[model samples]
Target: MKNILITGASRGIGRATALLAADRGWSVAINYASDAAAARSAAREVEARGSRALTVQGDVTDEAAVAAMFDTALDGLGGLDGVVVNAGVVAPSLPLAEMSLERLQRVFDINVLGSYLTAREAARRMSTDRGGRGGAMVVVSSAAARLGSPNEYVDYAGAKAALDAMTIGLSKELGPRGIRVNAVRPGLIETDIHASGGQPDRAARLGAATPLGRAGSADEVAESIVWLLSDAAAYANGAILDITGGR
Candidate 1:
């Protein structure tokens, strides 16, 4: 069976992806930052789907914590076949000039640096020459990278843009070594992330702008992420698959 490690699996898109992947028969490693209760509940659901699930606790921003999370997953499942680098952070909406350096750094520390650290470790353990099945990685980016989310949180967008670039480069760098890296740029989704950003109305505003006249669901984005890790996307390396409904 395939083993997939998903950061931020306690809620939102990460949780949704874990559910879907488990249903599809993939062993799931559910990583949560602080909500162990939620993580355990999600783990139970994943187990209900007839696939093994392991719950790991660690802050994504810490390299040691990230390494330990993976180590626990590897110990429990023996190996990892794919990973979803989905943990992220957002500060309150503020103009670029008004945003504090500390806030910006907080977002980047978890979103950009954390993603890099996770993918870096995965690459080391998943190298084709190491004698295991090739691995896949899917980063959850945001449409704000292109929309520019002016006056809201451009810094967050910028961080995601960096993630997008990393996904492309990593995909190319690891393709020859039998690894694939890709990203899913999602539009507004009904998740606690907006509330965490101190903008509970974000979904409404984004829905008005979306051509679909509605915000996407966490499940919708998660579906795309799961597909990107599937064998059907073997030829689709270094691609940023947009889940936004036409802008």
Candidate 2:
């Protein structure tokens, strides 16, 4: 069985991925930020699905905290096998001209800088050349990366676009180290993220226009993330897949 760590796994796509990965017999170490209660509940759910589970608390933007999260996960799981870079945030809708510096910093710091730090730690731990077994990495990007998210969240969009580039570069860099890297750019997923961005009904209102005629579920995105981490996608590398329902 595989052992995996998923950042922001207390709820939303991260939580869904953890549960599904557990269902497939993967030991899961879930990382949550400022939500001990929710993390505990998520861990219980993972255990119910017949997998070893642990929850670690950390803010992904902190380098020290990211490293500590990895250490805690490795200690709890006994090894490293996979990691999902899923922790991120979205701010209120605003045009690029109207956005504040603080907002931009928070968006990029978490989405771009935090993601890179988390992925770097995973690479360091799971690299075969580093006295560890090979592993897989899945970065949760967003449709905003490509769509530009104009007049809404250009900063968040730009951050994800940087992540997309990072995913591509890391795939090549880690491939030689025995880590497979891939990314999923999810579109209009029904999750708490919309609410956090100050528009709780955004997905519902926007999803109706998608070709699929509805918002995608966190479970839908989770399925692809777990697959990319499995041997089924052994040959898949540096791929930026879009789960946009043809939008």
Candidate 3:
């Protein structure tokens, strides 16, 4: 069976993707930062879907922890056929001039740095030259990477922008070595992330402005991610797919 590792798989788009992956008969490794209970709960759901499940805990910002996380997944799942780079965070709304140093560091450390570390680990393990079978990687970026999020979250926007660039470069670099790298930029989506960002209703408030006139769901974004990780997208590399509602 195909095996996949998804960071931040306890909830949001990550959880949705895990369920879909299970439906496809792929074994799932659900990675969580500190939510052991939640991760186990997600693991139960994956098992219920008739697919094997594994739960791994690691704070993506810690280098050693990230390595251990992958090692655990590798051991538990046998091998990884795909990886979903989805762990990230954002702070309360603030203009760039008013944002605190701590906020910026936290944003970039968990978002940009964590993403690079996760993708890097996946690359090392999944590269054909590294004694691994070829695989696929789906990075979760944000529409803010382009829209800039303006006065509210320019720091977050900037961090995600870095991911966008990384996804592009890694796709080309890894394609020849075996992995297909692609990214999804999700627009206004309903998730606890907005509440954590101190704007619980951000999606509903801004989604009406999109050409689709509605906010997207985590499931919607998950569909695209799972598809890209499947053979259906075998020819897709260095592709940055936008899940935005035409915002």
Q: State the weakest 10-residue window (summed lDDT) of model 3.
A: 238-247
lDDT of 2 by residue, 36-137 (tens): 999999999999999999999999999999999999999988998999999999999999999999999999999999999999999889999998798899
In model 3, the runs with Cα more than 4 Å from the true position are none
Q: Name the regions of candidate 1 deviating beyond 4 angstroms.
A: none
| Candidate-wise lDDT, in order | 0.90, 0.95, 0.95
What is the per-residue lDDT of model 3 for residues 49-84, given as tens digits with 9 covering 90 to 100?
999999999999999999999999999999999999
* Prediction 2 global C-alpha lDDT: 0.95
Model 2 clash pairs are none
Candidate 1's TM-score reads 0.97
Model 3 RMSD in angstroms = 0.7
Per residue, candidate 1 scores C-alpha lDDT tens digits across 15-80 of 999999998999999999999999999999999999999999998889999889888998898899
TM-scores for every candidate against the unseen true structure: 0.97, 0.99, 0.99
**Candidate 2 vs. true structure, TM-score:** 0.99
